[model samples]
Target: MYKYLFFLTASAVPGAALAQDSTEDALAEILAAQDATGPAEQPADNGGEQITIADQLVPSITVTANGLGTDIRNTGQAVTVIDREELVSIQGADPTRALQRVPGVSFSRNGPAGAFTGVNLRGAGSEQVLVLIDGVPVADPSSPAGGFDFGSLLTGTVSKIDVLRGSNSTIWGSDAIGGVIDISTRADTGMQGSLELGSRGTAFASALAGVSEDDFYVGLTGSWYETDGFSSAASGTEEDGFSQIAVGVTAFYDIADSLELSGHLNMSEGLLDIDGFPAPNFTLADTAETQKTLRYWGDIGLTYYGADLTLRARYSRADTDRSNRADTGTLSFESKGQMERADLRGEYRLVGGLSAAFGYDYQRNQYETSFDSFAQANIQGAYVQLGWVLGKLAVHAGGRIDDHDFFGSETSFGGDVSYGLKDDWRLRASFGEGFKAPSLFQLFSDYGNRDLQPELSTSFDLGIEKGQRGTGTHFALSGFRRDSEDLIDFVFCTGLLPSPCSPGQFGTYDNTERARAQGIEAEAGIDVVGTLRISGVYSFVDAEDRMTGLELARRPRHFGTLFADWEAGFGLSLGADLRIVGDSFNDAGNFTQIDGYELLDLRAAMPFGDNLEVFGRVENVFDIEYETVSGYGTAGRGVFAGVRAQM
Candidate 1:
């Protein structure tokens, strides 16, 4: 009976292989190699748990740019992984703060917590970067440019974040010109909870519970956060507040020895007070308004792991709704957006050290606005990748072809190579092409232009890295360049002759821009003493519009971060972080300039017993006033404290 059920479930879904292999094997190989030459494991500071050399490097499995599970070192692309432990150490409310420390990444927020936030990778716009929550795309289709807003994300439920830099459209399809950020939630079996209190009437609570056996597991997490924040406008006096609640559940069952089934659900609701720029003068206003947002996402999948082959099939969906209300209790605006996707992927190990991966993807995007009726778009794509690994050299190549309802067809290709020069030294290089189809809002809305072509980009990178496995010393330097053509931009219609004229009205989207971004990134980390560690990252970017030869707005040419941590006796730890950003233009014409600024943060934690711990952090220690976006307010010196329990 169970076998019949399993076959029925498998046959009901579309047949295709989705590459769903876990990186455990790759991680095991690294650990095994380190164990062969490294000393015995050391004791951790908190619970005296054994920590091996591989743990020092934060070894974990990663999906390569070509959609194959592999070790990070085997890939040529620039990548950064932040595990759960690191998130707790940062003491930030969201992943955006931690990502700022990564090389060649920049962030801009419109205001305090819960305000609109954007991330730029290697000088690419936010829309060019794909955001994935549990491997499902989460971009809001109703957004003007169809980008994921970082403000809606909280770290309470996340277990890991993988930031991959550079174009990866060959495998991920569209909207991957900048890179991909994959966020995975906790799946381990146990129970943990936390409570935090901070300045400005802030309160946060989160709990996670899970149980796992040999064949089946289930996990659930929920969190709530509220804060009485300052105004969004820099010069406003009225206070703006924000609150949010989120929940998630994940479950998996092994149908047979070689087959498994998994499902996930996550949702978040938030309300925030926001400020607007009044007309006529177009300056900050003290008036208060309210905005509410709801986000939902889920996925169900099946996987079969054979001796030398793996197949995966999955279906995922994401929906987002946003509404704004005026102080007079009148509905100001509202929008709804949804995305549904189906994927079938498979990977097979062929001859010695050779593997192949193939996948098919189908996606539907729908968006609706109070002013407009409804708009929808569909896309289909297929991809194939090949990887070869030799003694000291590895090579990967892939290509994808996508067919869009409006844009017709587009194709992309990418390749990467890595070679080990010595035991601890490696050299790598990669090149890729990216394409982004026009969003539904850009193609069918009031400002829509159906004639707009897809934006195209080409990117390249080369790097060298050195890692001392046991000594906890690592260093990397990389240089990258990206060229974008036929970029989309909105232009005003002046009702002039020989043009589509709608004088004094909102503009239409058009492909009228070209851009180029080139940069060098350097990072280093070292364990100074038995319980002390230091790390730093630096980025230098030259991002500009090719036609006007002007620097891109909001992207700092020079950005860097430095961090240090010390674990003292008695389960006590102290850490400090410093971030520096260079001056950047606030407008495309470079008329308004935002000044450079430096911020410093401090943190401390101490464990009381085996299951209880207390942690606190001070942000913006010096209270330096700065803004990532003009006319926006930034948080001042704030202190936060929290307690955690695990069972």
Candidate 2:
């Protein structure tokens, strides 16, 4: 039997080799055909995707989140696409670190996954950045009322991320006050995967493999990473750091000749150490923490009759435990808590170029603290969006109504209009009403009132895009002004603090007064020679409260990044990126300031074989000293090198 098996394997080797050659030849032919045909010959390119977000079907920059076939240049909206290569190069425990590369995107972290991590765009608050996984919303379950814990997510599970800035409120509602960040896992094309291990106390691995036929395909991916620290401090040292593990799979099946059904599920666990007793920048000597989060989304939908339909549902749960040992030798206590959510929604395109989408969402959250406090909150919302195209013009309109038992009712509306100017150039403008409901902590923290109203804002955006033959560039110059009402104000009330020092003023749900965030955003993607990616984004924002004449804390007046990626022969690639953030206030007190700084990063990958590669990266190449958070400093210089293997 062994002899027969060996003989059969040997005999099949030739066939396998022939198949591989045939596949490569076929791909070459397809690419050649596309180049010959040109985009003008493509149906969808002349249709919506080319005009909505980014080109979603073109192999060059195809993304699923846009629901179209055109490139971002055609979308007429200010949008950016970050692919797998970009995500891997930054090398951070949280995906948020990489977001800094994009214009108008900034984040704040509070102890990893245990507390709040804020993400804001174009002056919108962190909650304004709507988060999506494969077009599904992952509601916050731990909000005493309704606030998201941005760090609860693990980035390794993501295959790619699409960021649409400004008022995407017309296409997405709720947290879309700022914009939208849609993340999708890579689909199984044929069968490909990757694995890697690196230094800086790092161990990383990821795999994306599946089978794709004429009508169906299935893909699976899993990733895990462990790191000690890039810091010398105790909190930033080994044994007191962060670790994460995530896994996901997606399946696409064609039920009918022209109809397709697809779904995906992802889950992750993240751990980070937070020391509370230490000074602002000091590594924690006491009060360590462990946080775990589980999130998954599944959708079953169909496409038929010149239209597309899909339904989605998601569930996420997160829990955190803290062990604190008083430096004064009092006593150590543990605080345990949990958060969870469930959501469902659907979308469809109808006759003509008009499409409609609607869905129902229900969210619930519960948490318990050793301090003898337990709280529960609930919310429900429904939203619908409609889009239409006629001749050289396209329009999209949408609205969402949310009902919160604690905050009452809130409504949001957004719309965008675009028209072809001439010669592959399009002009677009947008307007919308954006809002953020007060967080539970802001409403009832320490000793606060439950009588807080939802925060509201009106936003405006304008831009243009052009696509030509040679030297094509995706360029957009946009500006937005958002006026907030009933803003939450956090003041160091003399009565609430344990000392004379000012208390940390959070927002006031009721006094959510007037604040404005106005900025200019422009990004250009130039196709240089042979798949070279030349991209740059510049943003200048003045985020200040017109009422108080003070700048918003943690926000920069100017920020920018310029980067390029070159694909070399033999699966080798090289990338270099530079990021700059202007000076900004660190606190409302307006006394302390987080100085502006610039940083550079470099990455190189060299293929060792068809399924293995070695890569190296250096972050903060200049060793710039900077801090996004006041008082707390970041790493000076960090290096990471690894070998990746796959089949």
Candidate 3:
């Protein structure tokens, strides 16, 4: 299945290898300059001299939430940034665990570790949220929903994660109905390694090595994890195990003072046990089944930075392969998917306090399954954005046009306004449009609908924020609404007298649903003492089908989180957090209701020296019995400890 991509990569390797000598020379020079500058400085502790809350805020150089590299505080969109320090403090094994605390975001997992997990943002399904790694889309085309599996993504090498809420189809072509999650890998010039052991017979290890200089940089990271996890079936006592290995590499070289070339490669492989059903009516059996997945992506790009303008051109390719095997070790299902993309973007400072950005992107997607032959599609998109700042007011607007091989064309537009008030207060509002074309499987498979229209959505939000820069206090309140149209679903044709299905066919896909979601989101944080801090977030969502007036499945109407952290002297810190999920229906008809639950987590860390630290955490402190998915078992109380070293 990967023959084409393998050959393409092989053909390009020689060229990259031929340039290795020059690259090494550049790297050596950069390393020397870095050494001369001395080692990087450690971040300042909050216990030291008091700093303004503004100074303590995350940096403003994010490029994902907005096309322009603007400060998040200045943008009129709801955004969350999780840096490396936060990840370490949370002690989460994967990205999904860390993201659960974010407002307006919820996850439904089938079972324990390595289970199939789905993320729902702002009441939108997993397929409506876009996932990116270093600005490259990573959805699996072979999957029914064409979404990325968050359970497979570990956080060992991640340096930053950005969550941009609401529709962003103007900037991202498709699958941006709910939001976007962009992940950035580490690029620090140092070495870091960690080893961990925990309950459920789990073991994990990771290593990172990187170096940076004045004009060149290179980094590599690798991690391995394995666990004898609990059974996935609700009534099963047999254990289900999982294992995974991942590696990533990144490099950059400056060909000239203003021109630079960069490349990144990421690969992961995993095997997981899944539960199978013996009968149809919601009964989960202990039948053994396993799945193996292999995923990889690589990107190479060149950028030219000038005093008034920046231009970049890049190409990327991603591929995924999956095989499902029965207890007898016979393959039952297999699928392969691949994506290739090329983008050319430019940002220009049109005038004082004003900027413009324009870009063109081309993509090709291909997928194949054991039951069907290969299928492919091509898409081309162009977008333009304008940003203007006048005094304390900022305005941004953008539009995009996408032409798909099968769907014809789609146009999306968005605009935002933000105004600063007195004393660090701000008012903001934004509106955006989103659209998602039918996936390849939905269009060409046996149960496909080639005449289906794209899913469409319009979203709006308004908010106000206040911050006390001097006292480490912050508060934000926001309200959002979204209307989705032409949602696709599979229906049994036998029910209809004049059935559209063939004689033996059971069902076919159709655009037969509409939905609306509205909610309020609130967040607050304050420092009560010198080194103690408390924070909380609450969300209320009313997500339902417009026609049936029934609540959406798996989306809780109310959810919230509260956390406290204390940094005592002697390089020791302790933290605790509580997550609350309200009751939700497990089925579309509002039957089979799932009860609400709350979980408490505790963590502690101690630093032995400047470069080494020991950390431990306890999840589900009360050993509560719960299930995120119907008829599935969840993990009980578990303890984990790990040691980390960096230089």
Top lDDT model: 1
Candidate 2 wrong stretches, greater than 4 Å: 1-76, 88-94, 109-117, 143-155, 167-171, 189-199, 211-218, 230-239, 249-265, 278-351, 372-374, 443-448, 468-471, 491-510, 527-533, 567-572
> In angstroms, what RMSD does candidate 3 have relative to the true structure?
8.3
Per-residue lDDT of model 1, residues 1-647, tens digit only? 01100111000000000001111211211111111111112112334332322242333545535565556666777888777788888875666768876888898887778888888999999888877666567778887888767875778776666788898899888898988776666655589988999988888887888776656667788888889989889999888888888887777777876677877777778888888867788677766778888877777778776555677787888777888888776998898888999988877667766778788989999999998779999999998888777766778888999999988999999999878786578898999999888888889887787777899999999999888311388899999999999999988776534443244446787888999999899999999988999999999999999989999999999999999889988889999999999999999999999999999999999999999999999989999999899988989999999999999
Lowest-sum lDDT 10-residue window in model 1: 10-19
Q: Indicate the TM-score of model 1.
A: 0.90
User: Native-vs-model 2 lDDT?
Assistant: 0.55
List the pairs of residues colliding in candidate 1.
Answer: 17-344, 17-345, 17-346, 18-345, 18-346
Q: Write the per-residue lDDT of candidate 3 for residues 1-647, one digit (tens) a residue.
A: 00000001100010000000011111111111011111111123345332322232233334555565555555788887777788889985666667876789888877767777788889998888887766556787788768666766677767667787898889888888988877766655689998889999988787888776555667888888888999989789888887888887878776876677877787878888888876565478676888888878777877775556667777888788889888889999998888899887777767656778788889998999999789998889999988776666777899999998887999999988878787778898999999888888888888886777789999999999887211378888999999999998888986776555655668987888999999999888899998999988889999999989999999999988888889988879999989999999999999898899999999999999899999999999999998788889999999999999988
Residue 330, candidate 3: alpha-carbon lDDT = 100
Residues 160-195, model 2: lDDT tens digits:
566777654433444566667766555534455444
TM-score of 2: 0.76
Which pairs of residues clash in candidate 3, taking residues 3 or more apart in a chain or in different chains? 53-469
Clashes of each: 5, 17, 1
Order of quality (TM-score): 1, 3, 2
Global fold similarity of model 3 (TM-score): 0.90
